[model samples]
Target chain A: MELFTYENIIGIAAGICTSIAMLPQLIKVIKTKETADLSVTMIGVLIVGVSLWVYYGFLQNEVPIILSNSFSVVVNLTLLICWFLFRKKS
Target chain B: MELFTYENIIGIAAGICTSIAMLPQLIKVIKTKETADLSVTMIGVLIVGVSLWVYYGFLQNEVPIILSNSFSVVVNLTLLICWFLFRKKS
Candidate 1:
Protein backbone atom coordinates (compact mmCIF):
# COMPACT_ATOMS: atom_id res chain seq x y z
CA MET A 1 0.00 0.00 0.00
CA GLU A 2 1.30 3.39 -0.94
CA LEU A 3 1.43 5.78 2.01
CA PHE A 4 1.39 9.56 1.44
CA THR A 5 -0.97 9.23 -1.46
CA TYR A 6 -3.21 12.16 -2.31
CA GLU A 7 -6.15 10.75 -0.41
CA ASN A 8 -3.96 9.94 2.55
CA ILE A 9 -2.64 13.48 2.60
CA ILE A 10 -6.13 14.87 2.54
CA GLY A 11 -7.18 12.53 5.32
CA ILE A 12 -4.19 13.49 7.40
CA ALA A 13 -4.82 17.17 6.80
CA ALA A 14 -8.43 16.78 7.81
CA GLY A 15 -7.39 14.93 10.92
CA ILE A 16 -4.93 17.63 11.85
CA CYS A 17 -7.46 20.35 11.20
CA THR A 18 -10.16 18.77 13.37
CA SER A 19 -7.75 17.65 16.04
CA ILE A 20 -6.56 21.21 16.60
CA ALA A 21 -9.68 23.07 15.58
CA MET A 22 -11.12 23.32 19.09
CA LEU A 23 -7.93 24.55 20.70
CA PRO A 24 -8.55 28.04 19.43
CA GLN A 25 -12.08 27.97 20.81
CA LEU A 26 -10.79 26.73 24.12
CA ILE A 27 -8.29 29.54 24.21
CA LYS A 28 -10.93 32.06 23.24
CA VAL A 29 -13.27 30.84 25.96
CA ILE A 30 -10.56 30.90 28.57
CA LYS A 31 -9.26 34.28 27.48
CA THR A 32 -12.65 35.90 27.33
CA LYS A 33 -14.12 33.85 30.14
CA GLU A 34 -17.28 33.73 28.11
CA THR A 35 -19.65 30.94 27.22
CA ALA A 36 -22.93 32.63 26.56
CA ASP A 37 -23.01 31.86 22.85
CA LEU A 38 -21.60 28.41 23.14
CA SER A 39 -23.89 25.39 23.23
CA VAL A 40 -23.36 22.76 25.90
CA THR A 41 -25.15 20.09 23.86
CA MET A 42 -22.87 20.61 20.91
CA ILE A 43 -19.71 20.14 22.93
CA GLY A 44 -21.15 17.23 24.86
CA VAL A 45 -22.26 15.40 21.76
CA LEU A 46 -18.93 16.03 20.12
CA ILE A 47 -17.10 14.52 23.07
CA VAL A 48 -19.12 11.34 22.83
CA GLY A 49 -18.83 11.26 19.07
CA VAL A 50 -15.07 11.77 19.09
CA SER A 51 -14.62 9.24 21.84
CA LEU A 52 -16.43 6.67 19.69
CA TRP A 53 -14.11 7.50 16.84
CA VAL A 54 -11.18 6.91 19.14
CA TYR A 55 -12.54 3.52 20.11
CA TYR A 56 -13.24 2.60 16.52
CA GLY A 57 -9.70 3.60 15.63
CA PHE A 58 -8.47 1.39 18.40
CA LEU A 59 -10.47 -1.55 17.09
CA GLN A 60 -8.89 -1.04 13.71
CA ASN A 61 -5.50 -0.25 15.19
CA GLU A 62 -5.26 2.95 13.18
CA VAL A 63 -2.76 5.00 15.06
CA PRO A 64 -3.38 8.25 13.25
CA ILE A 65 -7.10 8.25 13.84
CA ILE A 66 -6.63 7.25 17.43
CA LEU A 67 -4.05 9.93 18.12
CA SER A 68 -5.86 12.74 16.31
CA ASN A 69 -9.32 12.07 17.70
CA SER A 70 -7.83 11.57 21.14
CA PHE A 71 -6.33 15.01 20.84
CA SER A 72 -9.68 16.35 19.74
CA VAL A 73 -11.34 14.73 22.75
CA VAL A 74 -8.88 16.40 25.12
CA VAL A 75 -9.40 19.80 23.56
CA ASN A 76 -13.14 19.21 23.57
CA LEU A 77 -13.15 18.16 27.21
CA THR A 78 -11.34 21.32 28.19
CA LEU A 79 -13.70 23.36 26.12
CA LEU A 80 -16.68 21.77 27.85
CA ILE A 81 -15.15 22.21 31.26
CA CYS A 82 -14.46 25.83 30.53
CA TRP A 83 -17.99 26.22 29.31
CA PHE A 84 -19.32 24.82 32.55
CA LEU A 85 -17.15 27.10 34.65
CA PHE A 86 -17.98 30.18 32.67
CA ARG A 87 -21.53 29.47 31.63
CA LYS A 88 -23.23 30.68 34.77
CA LYS A 89 -20.79 33.51 35.26
CA SER A 90 -21.45 35.03 31.85
CA MET B 1 -16.88 -7.33 4.58
CA GLU B 2 -19.41 -7.86 7.27
CA LEU B 3 -21.95 -5.09 7.53
CA PHE B 4 -23.07 -3.81 10.91
CA THR B 5 -20.18 -5.37 12.71
CA TYR B 6 -19.42 -3.94 16.14
CA GLU B 7 -16.73 -1.70 14.84
CA ASN B 8 -18.85 -0.63 11.90
CA ILE B 9 -21.70 0.24 14.25
CA ILE B 10 -19.37 2.31 16.38
CA GLY B 11 -18.09 4.09 13.32
CA ILE B 12 -21.59 4.84 12.15
CA ALA B 13 -22.63 6.05 15.57
CA ALA B 14 -19.64 8.32 15.71
CA GLY B 15 -20.48 9.65 12.29
CA ILE B 16 -24.06 10.38 13.27
CA CYS B 17 -23.05 12.07 16.49
CA THR B 18 -20.51 14.33 14.82
CA SER B 19 -22.70 15.03 11.83
CA ILE B 20 -25.48 16.40 14.02
CA ALA B 21 -23.41 17.78 16.86
CA MET B 22 -23.42 21.38 15.62
CA LEU B 23 -27.17 21.55 15.16
CA PRO B 24 -27.88 22.65 18.69
CA GLN B 25 -25.33 25.39 18.39
CA LEU B 26 -26.90 26.56 15.16
CA ILE B 27 -30.32 26.57 16.72
CA LYS B 28 -29.01 28.49 19.69
CA VAL B 29 -27.44 31.05 17.42
CA ILE B 30 -30.61 31.45 15.41
CA LYS B 31 -32.98 31.59 18.35
CA THR B 32 -30.82 33.68 20.62
CA LYS B 33 -29.27 35.82 17.86
CA GLU B 34 -25.91 35.71 19.57
CA THR B 35 -22.37 34.92 18.57
CA ALA B 36 -20.09 36.84 20.86
CA ASP B 37 -18.65 33.79 22.53
CA LEU B 38 -18.31 31.84 19.34
CA SER B 39 -14.95 31.68 17.57
CA VAL B 40 -15.02 32.40 13.87
CA THR B 41 -11.70 30.70 13.33
CA MET B 42 -12.92 27.45 14.87
CA ILE B 43 -15.98 27.27 12.66
CA GLY B 44 -13.95 28.18 9.57
CA VAL B 45 -11.32 25.59 10.33
CA LEU B 46 -13.98 22.96 10.98
CA ILE B 47 -15.68 23.72 7.69
CA VAL B 48 -12.42 23.27 5.83
CA GLY B 49 -11.59 20.15 7.75
CA VAL B 50 -14.97 18.52 7.32
CA SER B 51 -15.05 19.45 3.66
CA LEU B 52 -11.70 17.80 3.20
CA TRP B 53 -13.05 14.72 4.91
CA VAL B 54 -15.95 14.69 2.48
CA TYR B 55 -13.60 14.84 -0.45
CA TYR B 56 -11.44 12.17 1.04
CA GLY B 57 -14.47 9.99 1.55
CA PHE B 58 -15.45 10.51 -2.04
CA LEU B 59 -12.03 9.51 -3.26
CA GLN B 60 -12.13 6.43 -1.09
CA ASN B 61 -15.69 5.51 -2.17
CA GLU B 62 -16.98 5.63 1.37
CA VAL B 63 -20.64 6.55 1.19
CA PRO B 64 -21.23 6.90 4.91
CA ILE B 65 -18.30 9.21 5.45
CA ILE B 66 -19.24 11.32 2.44
CA LEU B 67 -22.87 11.64 3.50
CA SER B 68 -22.14 12.38 7.13
CA ASN B 69 -19.44 14.89 6.47
CA SER B 70 -21.58 16.53 3.83
CA PHE B 71 -24.29 17.01 6.43
CA SER B 72 -21.76 18.31 8.89
CA VAL B 73 -20.42 20.79 6.32
CA VAL B 74 -23.88 22.15 5.69
CA VAL B 75 -24.53 22.53 9.39
CA ASN B 76 -21.20 24.20 9.97
CA LEU B 77 -21.74 26.57 7.05
CA THR B 78 -25.14 27.57 8.39
CA LEU B 79 -23.63 28.06 11.81
CA LEU B 80 -21.03 30.36 10.30
CA ILE B 81 -23.66 32.25 8.37
CA CYS B 82 -25.75 32.61 11.47
CA TRP B 83 -22.74 33.90 13.30
CA PHE B 84 -22.24 36.52 10.62
CA LEU B 85 -25.87 37.50 10.73
CA PHE B 86 -25.95 37.84 14.50
CA ARG B 87 -22.42 38.71 15.56
CA LYS B 88 -22.82 42.39 14.95
CA LYS B 89 -26.28 42.46 16.41
CA SER B 90 -25.12 40.93 19.65
Candidate 2:
Protein backbone atom coordinates (compact mmCIF):
# COMPACT_ATOMS: atom_id res chain seq x y z
CA MET A 1 0.00 0.00 0.00
CA GLU A 2 1.35 3.37 -0.94
CA LEU A 3 1.23 5.88 1.85
CA PHE A 4 -0.01 9.37 1.13
CA THR A 5 2.57 12.07 1.53
CA TYR A 6 2.54 14.29 4.64
CA GLU A 7 1.62 17.31 2.56
CA ASN A 8 -1.40 15.60 1.08
CA ILE A 9 -2.54 14.44 4.50
CA ILE A 10 -2.12 17.88 5.98
CA GLY A 11 -4.09 19.44 3.18
CA ILE A 12 -6.90 16.95 3.58
CA ALA A 13 -6.89 17.35 7.37
CA ALA A 14 -7.08 21.12 7.20
CA GLY A 15 -9.94 20.85 4.79
CA ILE A 16 -11.84 18.59 7.14
CA CYS A 17 -11.27 20.86 10.14
CA THR A 18 -12.37 24.03 8.39
CA SER A 19 -15.37 22.32 6.88
CA ILE A 20 -16.47 21.01 10.27
CA ALA A 21 -16.00 24.42 11.79
CA MET A 22 -18.44 25.98 9.35
CA LEU A 23 -21.21 23.53 10.19
CA PRO A 24 -22.64 25.06 13.37
CA GLN A 25 -22.88 28.58 12.00
CA LEU A 26 -24.51 27.45 8.80
CA ILE A 27 -26.96 25.33 10.72
CA LYS A 28 -27.77 28.15 13.12
CA VAL A 29 -28.40 30.66 10.34
CA ILE A 30 -30.75 28.36 8.49
CA LYS A 31 -32.80 27.32 11.45
CA THR A 32 -33.08 30.58 13.34
CA LYS A 33 -33.43 32.77 10.27
CA GLU A 34 -31.17 35.28 11.92
CA THR A 35 -27.73 36.42 10.83
CA ALA A 36 -27.64 39.58 12.91
CA ASP A 37 -24.76 38.56 15.11
CA LEU A 38 -22.36 38.28 12.21
CA SER A 39 -20.67 41.35 10.75
CA VAL A 40 -21.16 42.46 7.15
CA THR A 41 -17.64 43.72 6.72
CA MET A 42 -16.11 40.48 7.86
CA ILE A 43 -18.28 38.45 5.55
CA GLY A 44 -17.54 40.79 2.69
CA VAL A 45 -13.86 40.52 3.25
CA LEU A 46 -14.14 36.75 3.34
CA ILE A 47 -16.12 36.59 0.12
CA VAL A 48 -13.53 38.67 -1.70
CA GLY A 49 -10.77 36.63 -0.19
CA VAL A 50 -12.32 33.36 -1.32
CA SER A 51 -12.86 34.72 -4.79
CA LEU A 52 -9.19 35.56 -4.93
CA TRP A 53 -8.43 32.00 -3.88
CA VAL A 54 -10.48 30.72 -6.79
CA TYR A 55 -8.59 32.96 -9.19
CA TYR A 56 -5.30 31.94 -7.72
CA GLY A 57 -6.29 28.31 -8.14
CA PHE A 58 -7.13 28.88 -11.76
CA LEU A 59 -3.87 30.67 -12.40
CA GLN A 60 -1.88 27.84 -10.85
CA ASN A 61 -4.03 25.14 -12.42
CA GLU A 62 -4.56 23.52 -9.03
CA VAL A 63 -7.58 21.26 -8.86
CA PRO A 64 -8.04 21.12 -5.07
CA ILE A 65 -7.90 24.87 -4.64
CA ILE A 66 -10.35 25.50 -7.44
CA LEU A 67 -12.85 22.86 -6.38
CA SER A 68 -12.77 23.75 -2.69
CA ASN A 69 -13.18 27.50 -3.14
CA SER A 70 -15.79 27.15 -5.87
CA PHE A 71 -17.95 25.12 -3.55
CA SER A 72 -17.33 27.61 -0.75
CA VAL A 73 -18.38 30.51 -2.99
CA VAL A 74 -21.66 28.76 -3.71
CA VAL A 75 -22.33 28.00 -0.05
CA ASN A 76 -21.47 31.50 1.14
CA LEU A 77 -23.67 32.97 -1.58
CA THR A 78 -26.56 30.82 -0.41
CA LEU A 79 -26.15 32.14 3.10
CA LEU A 80 -26.23 35.68 1.73
CA ILE A 81 -29.45 34.90 -0.08
CA CYS A 82 -31.00 33.58 3.10
CA TRP A 83 -29.97 36.72 4.90
CA PHE A 84 -31.71 38.81 2.24
CA LEU A 85 -34.92 36.86 2.53
CA PHE A 86 -34.84 37.13 6.30
CA ARG A 87 -34.39 40.87 6.01
CA LYS A 88 -37.20 41.23 3.51
CA LYS A 89 -39.57 39.43 5.81
CA SER A 90 -38.55 41.42 8.86
CA MET B 1 0.23 53.09 -14.29
CA GLU B 2 0.98 49.43 -14.82
CA LEU B 3 -2.05 47.34 -15.73
CA PHE B 4 -2.32 44.00 -14.02
CA THR B 5 -2.31 40.92 -16.20
CA TYR B 6 -5.71 39.38 -16.95
CA GLU B 7 -4.91 36.48 -14.67
CA ASN B 8 -4.07 38.79 -11.79
CA ILE B 9 -7.19 40.82 -12.36
CA ILE B 10 -9.36 37.74 -12.46
CA GLY B 11 -7.86 36.54 -9.23
CA ILE B 12 -8.54 39.89 -7.61
CA ALA B 13 -12.09 40.02 -8.97
CA ALA B 14 -13.01 36.62 -7.69
CA GLY B 15 -11.58 37.48 -4.30
CA ILE B 16 -13.57 40.68 -4.10
CA CYS B 17 -16.82 39.08 -5.24
CA THR B 18 -16.62 36.19 -2.85
CA SER B 19 -15.67 38.47 0.00
CA ILE B 20 -18.58 40.82 -0.70
CA ALA B 21 -21.01 37.94 -0.85
CA MET B 22 -20.25 36.91 2.71
CA LEU B 23 -21.13 40.30 4.17
CA PRO B 24 -24.93 40.23 4.32
CA GLN B 25 -25.11 36.84 5.89
CA LEU B 26 -22.53 37.70 8.50
CA ILE B 27 -24.32 40.90 9.29
CA LYS B 28 -27.69 39.22 9.57
CA VAL B 29 -26.34 36.57 11.86
CA ILE B 30 -24.81 39.13 14.17
CA LYS B 31 -27.81 41.41 14.32
CA THR B 32 -30.51 38.80 14.77
CA LYS B 33 -28.60 36.28 16.82
CA GLU B 34 -30.30 33.68 14.72
CA THR B 35 -28.32 31.12 12.81
CA ALA B 36 -30.85 28.34 12.93
CA ASP B 37 -31.45 28.46 9.20
CA LEU B 38 -27.90 27.50 8.43
CA SER B 39 -26.89 23.83 8.21
CA VAL B 40 -24.16 22.33 10.30
CA THR B 41 -23.07 20.04 7.51
CA MET B 42 -22.80 22.85 5.03
CA ILE B 43 -20.74 25.10 7.29
CA GLY B 44 -18.61 22.16 8.27
CA VAL B 45 -17.91 21.36 4.69
CA LEU B 46 -16.98 24.95 3.94
CA ILE B 47 -14.58 25.19 6.85
CA VAL B 48 -12.87 22.02 5.78
CA GLY B 49 -12.72 23.11 2.17
CA VAL B 50 -11.16 26.44 3.09
CA SER B 51 -8.63 24.73 5.31
CA LEU B 52 -7.61 22.56 2.40
CA TRP B 53 -7.28 25.65 0.25
CA VAL B 54 -4.87 27.07 2.79
CA TYR B 55 -2.84 23.91 2.74
CA TYR B 56 -2.88 23.88 -1.03
CA GLY B 57 -1.68 27.47 -1.05
CA PHE B 58 1.14 26.62 1.25
CA LEU B 59 2.13 23.65 -0.83
CA GLN B 60 2.21 25.76 -3.98
CA ASN B 61 4.13 28.55 -2.30
CA GLU B 62 1.42 30.98 -3.33
CA VAL B 63 1.10 34.21 -1.34
CA PRO B 64 -2.41 35.26 -2.35
CA ILE B 65 -3.91 31.85 -1.74
CA ILE B 66 -2.35 31.55 1.67
CA LEU B 67 -3.26 35.02 2.86
CA SER B 68 -6.85 34.94 1.63
CA ASN B 69 -7.71 31.51 2.97
CA SER B 70 -5.96 32.17 6.24
CA PHE B 71 -8.20 35.14 6.81
CA SER B 72 -11.26 33.15 5.80
CA VAL B 73 -10.44 30.44 8.29
CA VAL B 74 -10.27 33.03 11.01
CA VAL B 75 -13.58 34.60 10.05
CA ASN B 76 -15.40 31.34 9.66
CA LEU B 77 -14.09 30.20 12.99
CA THR B 78 -15.42 33.34 14.60
CA LEU B 79 -18.86 32.66 13.18
CA LEU B 80 -18.71 29.21 14.64
CA ILE B 81 -17.92 30.67 18.02
CA CYS B 82 -20.88 32.99 17.77
CA TRP B 83 -23.11 30.08 16.85
CA PHE B 84 -22.02 28.22 19.95
CA LEU B 85 -22.82 31.16 22.14
CA PHE B 86 -26.17 31.61 20.47
CA ARG B 87 -26.99 27.97 20.90
CA LYS B 88 -26.08 28.05 24.54
CA LYS B 89 -28.41 30.98 25.11
CA SER B 90 -31.38 29.36 23.42
Candidate 3:
Protein backbone atom coordinates (compact mmCIF):
# COMPACT_ATOMS: atom_id res chain seq x y z
CA MET A 1 0.00 0.00 0.00
CA GLU A 2 1.28 3.44 -0.82
CA LEU A 3 2.01 5.80 2.09
CA PHE A 4 0.12 8.77 0.63
CA THR A 5 -2.29 8.85 -2.25
CA TYR A 6 -3.61 11.78 -4.23
CA GLU A 7 -6.89 11.41 -2.36
CA ASN A 8 -5.14 11.79 0.96
CA ILE A 9 -3.30 14.86 -0.25
CA ILE A 10 -6.53 16.45 -1.43
CA GLY A 11 -8.24 15.53 1.81
CA ILE A 12 -5.45 17.17 3.75
CA ALA A 13 -5.75 20.23 1.59
CA ALA A 14 -9.49 20.29 2.16
CA GLY A 15 -8.99 19.96 5.86
CA ILE A 16 -6.54 22.82 6.02
CA CYS A 17 -8.75 25.06 3.92
CA THR A 18 -11.91 24.34 5.89
CA SER A 19 -10.25 24.51 9.26
CA ILE A 20 -9.42 28.20 8.87
CA ALA A 21 -12.08 29.29 6.42
CA MET A 22 -13.96 31.29 9.03
CA LEU A 23 -10.97 33.24 10.34
CA PRO A 24 -11.24 36.04 7.86
CA GLN A 25 -14.88 36.56 8.70
CA LEU A 26 -14.10 36.60 12.38
CA ILE A 27 -11.37 39.16 11.86
CA LYS A 28 -13.59 41.28 9.69
CA VAL A 29 -16.42 41.15 12.18
CA ILE A 30 -14.14 42.18 14.98
CA LYS A 31 -12.48 44.92 13.01
CA THR A 32 -15.58 46.47 11.53
CA LYS A 33 -18.14 45.67 14.23
CA GLU A 34 -20.49 44.52 11.51
CA THR A 35 -22.65 41.44 11.84
CA ALA A 36 -26.12 42.70 11.06
CA ASP A 37 -25.83 41.55 7.50
CA LEU A 38 -24.51 38.12 8.44
CA SER A 39 -26.92 35.26 8.64
CA VAL A 40 -27.59 33.87 12.08
CA THR A 41 -29.01 30.68 10.68
CA MET A 42 -25.82 29.94 8.78
CA ILE A 43 -23.69 30.33 11.88
CA GLY A 44 -26.04 28.25 13.93
CA VAL A 45 -26.09 25.44 11.42
CA LEU A 46 -22.33 25.53 11.02
CA ILE A 47 -21.86 25.17 14.75
CA VAL A 48 -24.10 22.16 14.76
CA GLY A 49 -22.30 20.64 11.79
CA VAL A 50 -18.80 21.10 13.17
CA SER A 51 -19.92 19.80 16.55
CA LEU A 52 -21.20 16.64 14.93
CA TRP A 53 -17.97 16.29 12.97
CA VAL A 54 -16.08 16.47 16.22
CA TYR A 55 -18.30 13.85 17.74
CA TYR A 56 -17.89 11.67 14.69
CA GLY A 57 -14.14 12.07 14.90
CA PHE A 58 -14.14 11.04 18.54
CA LEU A 59 -16.23 7.97 17.74
CA GLN A 60 -13.98 7.06 14.85
CA ASN A 61 -10.78 7.75 16.76
CA GLU A 62 -9.60 10.25 14.20
CA VAL A 63 -7.41 12.82 15.89
CA PRO A 64 -7.12 15.21 12.98
CA ILE A 65 -10.83 15.36 12.31
CA ILE A 66 -11.52 15.94 15.96
CA LEU A 67 -8.97 18.75 16.22
CA SER A 68 -10.03 20.42 13.02
CA ASN A 69 -13.73 20.31 13.79
CA SER A 70 -13.10 21.42 17.33
CA PHE A 71 -11.25 24.47 16.11
CA SER A 72 -13.92 25.20 13.53
CA VAL A 73 -16.67 24.86 16.09
CA VAL A 74 -14.96 27.29 18.42
CA VAL A 75 -14.29 29.81 15.73
CA ASN A 76 -17.81 29.57 14.39
CA LEU A 77 -19.28 29.90 17.86
CA THR A 78 -17.15 32.93 18.45
CA LEU A 79 -18.49 34.41 15.27
CA LEU A 80 -22.02 33.73 16.41
CA ILE A 81 -21.42 35.44 19.69
CA CYS A 82 -19.81 38.33 17.90
CA TRP A 83 -22.88 38.64 15.76
CA PHE A 84 -25.02 39.00 18.81
CA LEU A 85 -22.67 41.42 20.50
CA PHE A 86 -21.75 43.61 17.59
CA ARG A 87 -24.92 43.87 15.58
CA LYS A 88 -26.15 47.44 15.33
CA LYS A 89 -29.23 48.31 17.34
CA SER A 90 -31.27 50.19 14.81
CA MET B 1 -19.73 -5.78 12.26
CA GLU B 2 -22.90 -3.78 12.31
CA LEU B 3 -23.67 -1.83 9.19
CA PHE B 4 -24.42 1.42 11.00
CA THR B 5 -22.60 2.67 14.07
CA TYR B 6 -22.75 5.75 16.24
CA GLU B 7 -19.80 7.17 14.38
CA ASN B 8 -21.50 6.68 11.05
CA ILE B 9 -24.69 8.26 12.30
CA ILE B 10 -22.86 11.30 13.57
CA GLY B 11 -20.92 11.56 10.37
CA ILE B 12 -24.11 11.51 8.35
CA ALA B 13 -25.64 14.13 10.56
CA ALA B 14 -22.55 16.25 10.21
CA GLY B 15 -22.62 15.88 6.48
CA ILE B 16 -26.23 16.92 6.27
CA CYS B 17 -25.67 19.89 8.51
CA THR B 18 -22.64 21.18 6.68
CA SER B 19 -24.20 20.56 3.31
CA ILE B 20 -27.01 23.03 3.85
CA ALA B 21 -25.37 25.40 6.29
CA MET B 22 -24.72 27.97 3.61
CA LEU B 23 -28.23 27.96 2.26
CA PRO B 24 -29.51 30.44 4.75
CA GLN B 25 -26.72 32.83 3.95
CA LEU B 26 -27.37 32.56 0.27
CA ILE B 27 -31.03 33.29 0.78
CA LYS B 28 -30.22 36.22 3.00
CA VAL B 29 -27.83 37.70 0.46
CA ILE B 30 -30.35 37.32 -2.29
CA LYS B 31 -33.19 38.77 -0.27
CA THR B 32 -31.49 41.66 1.47
CA LYS B 33 -28.84 42.44 -1.10
CA GLU B 34 -26.26 42.74 1.63
CA THR B 35 -22.71 41.55 1.23
CA ALA B 36 -20.64 44.50 2.23
CA ASP B 37 -20.31 43.27 5.80
CA LEU B 38 -19.17 39.88 4.60
CA SER B 39 -15.48 39.13 4.12
CA VAL B 40 -14.27 38.39 0.62
CA THR B 41 -11.20 36.65 1.99
CA MET B 42 -13.36 34.22 3.88
CA ILE B 43 -15.43 33.48 0.80
CA GLY B 44 -12.30 33.09 -1.32
CA VAL B 45 -10.73 30.69 1.15
CA LEU B 46 -13.98 28.76 1.45
CA ILE B 47 -14.17 28.40 -2.33
CA VAL B 48 -10.68 26.97 -2.32
CA GLY B 49 -11.55 24.73 0.58
CA VAL B 50 -14.77 23.35 -0.86
CA SER B 51 -13.17 22.89 -4.25
CA LEU B 52 -10.47 20.78 -2.62
CA TRP B 53 -13.20 18.85 -0.86
CA VAL B 54 -14.84 18.17 -4.20
CA TYR B 55 -11.50 17.01 -5.61
CA TYR B 56 -10.90 14.93 -2.54
CA GLY B 57 -14.35 13.46 -2.89
CA PHE B 58 -13.68 12.52 -6.49
CA LEU B 59 -10.44 10.87 -5.48
CA GLN B 60 -12.08 9.00 -2.59
CA ASN B 61 -15.31 8.26 -4.39
CA GLU B 62 -17.28 10.15 -1.76
CA VAL B 63 -20.44 11.20 -3.48
CA PRO B 64 -21.83 13.05 -0.49
CA ILE B 65 -18.73 15.13 0.02
CA ILE B 66 -18.60 16.00 -3.63
CA LEU B 67 -22.24 17.00 -3.78
CA SER B 68 -22.14 18.99 -0.58
CA ASN B 69 -18.98 20.87 -1.39
CA SER B 70 -20.17 21.55 -4.88
CA PHE B 71 -23.31 23.20 -3.54
CA SER B 72 -21.29 25.17 -1.04
CA VAL B 73 -18.86 26.30 -3.69
CA VAL B 74 -21.64 27.61 -5.88
CA VAL B 75 -23.32 29.44 -3.04
CA ASN B 76 -20.08 30.97 -1.82
CA LEU B 77 -19.20 32.04 -5.34
CA THR B 78 -22.60 33.63 -5.70
CA LEU B 79 -22.06 35.39 -2.41
CA LEU B 80 -18.70 36.62 -3.63
CA ILE B 81 -20.21 37.93 -6.80
CA CYS B 82 -22.97 39.53 -4.76
CA TRP B 83 -20.25 41.19 -2.73
CA PHE B 84 -18.89 42.69 -5.90
CA LEU B 85 -22.25 43.66 -7.31
CA PHE B 86 -24.27 44.80 -4.30
CA ARG B 87 -21.68 46.39 -2.08
CA LYS B 88 -22.75 49.89 -1.14
CA LYS B 89 -21.72 52.47 -3.72
CA SER B 90 -20.12 54.67 -1.10
User: Which candidate number has the best TM-score?
Assistant: 1
Q: Candidates' TM-scores? A: 0.77, 0.55, 0.71
Candidate 1 residue lDDT tens string, A30-69: 8999988677888889899999988977786555457778
Q: What is the C-alpha lDDT of each candidate?
A: 0.80, 0.64, 0.75
- Candidate 2 docks at the CAPRI level of acceptable
After TM-score superposition, the amount by which residue A44's alpha carbon in candidate 1 deviates from its true location, in angstroms, is 3.5
Descending-DockQ candidate ranking: 1, 3, 2
For residues B1-90, what per-residue lDDT tens digits would candidate 2 score against the true structure? 233666556665665565555556666778888877555556666677677767776775655556656766776776777687786554
Interface RMSD of 1: 2.1
RMSD of 1: 3.1
Task: Report the lDDT tens digits of candidate 3 across residue range B1-90.
Answer: 343566556766787898777677788778889776577887888899889878866665545456667878888899988888898741
> Against the true two-chain complex, what DockQ does each candidate achieve?
0.66, 0.36, 0.64
What are the C-alpha RMSDs, in order, of all predicted structures? 3.1, 6.6, 4.0
Worst ten in a row by lDDT for model 3 chain B: B1-10
A1-90: candidate 3 lDDT, tens digit per residue: 342566666666777887777677788778888887677887888899989878866665545456668888889889888888877651
Off by over 4 Å in 2: A1-56, A68-90, B1-9
